[model samples]
Target: MITVDTVCALIAKKLGSKATDLTLGADTAFDSVGLSSLQIADIVYTIEDDAEVELDPSQAANVKTVGDLVELVETTRAAGAAA
Candidate 1:
């Protein structure tokens, strides 16, 4: 299972912001925090590069919320570890 905390932490790191500025629960949109389509692409590439895993394009689209992002990371990490 994924948690909002993990997703927010990664988002904060990617945005070069403090974790406190991001909360796990209640936040709905990623763009509100300044993440654009370009930035999201960058973030996805960075996640693949840093995490060393492949993401399904379809699955990536499912990552709209913080919980979804956390699940993506966890699933990607798990996939990487298995390989």
Candidate 2:
């Protein structure tokens, strides 16, 4: 059920004041929003924790956009449920 908005909210929460003026969307690149690698990792960790699913580190590393992170979360959640 993870969506782009969910990820965007997480990013915004992490960014705080930095996100006030940024327009977050599915296709928006992480770099475009001025996200650092550490920030991304923290967001991913939060997602994994919230979803109660551990995502593949390799796949997580490849996520570049909000949509990508959402998809990864959904996919990982689905796989965990299926198992």
Candidate 3:
């Protein structure tokens, strides 16, 4: 059920007023939106906490776009459910 919008909303929620000027979409690159590495890490941590699952750090490092994060979240959630 994890979708791009879900991830985008999470980012918006995390960033608060800082995200107001950014347009978020599936293809939106984190860097394009002016997200720093620390911001990205914070977002990833938020996702992990919200999902109650620990994502592979290596896999998280490869995420570049909103779609990529959504895919990672979905994959992690599915894997957790299967287990």
Choose the strongest candidate by TM-score. 2
Q: Residue by residue across 13-38, what tens digits does model 3's lDDT show? A: 86789899888999988888767799
Q: Which window of 10 residues has the lowest lDDT sum in candidate 2?
A: 1-10
User: Which is better, 1 or 2, measured by TM-score?
Assistant: 2
Q: What TM-score do all the candidates reach, one by one? A: 0.58, 0.90, 0.82
Q: Lowest summed lDDT over 10 consecutive residues: which window, candidate 3?
A: 1-10
Which of candidates 1 and 2 reaches a greater lDDT? Answer: 2
Q: Tell me the whole-model lDDT of each prediction, alpha carbons only.
A: 0.66, 0.89, 0.86
Predictions: Cα RMSD each: 4.0, 1.1, 1.9
Model 1 spans > 4 angstroms off: 1-28, 79-83
lDDT of 2 at 32: 85
Per-model tally of clashing residue pairs: 0, 0, 0
Best by lDDT: 2
lDDT of 1 by residue, 1-83 (tens): 43565456566776784446655453545776767787777766666666566788889876776656666878888877888
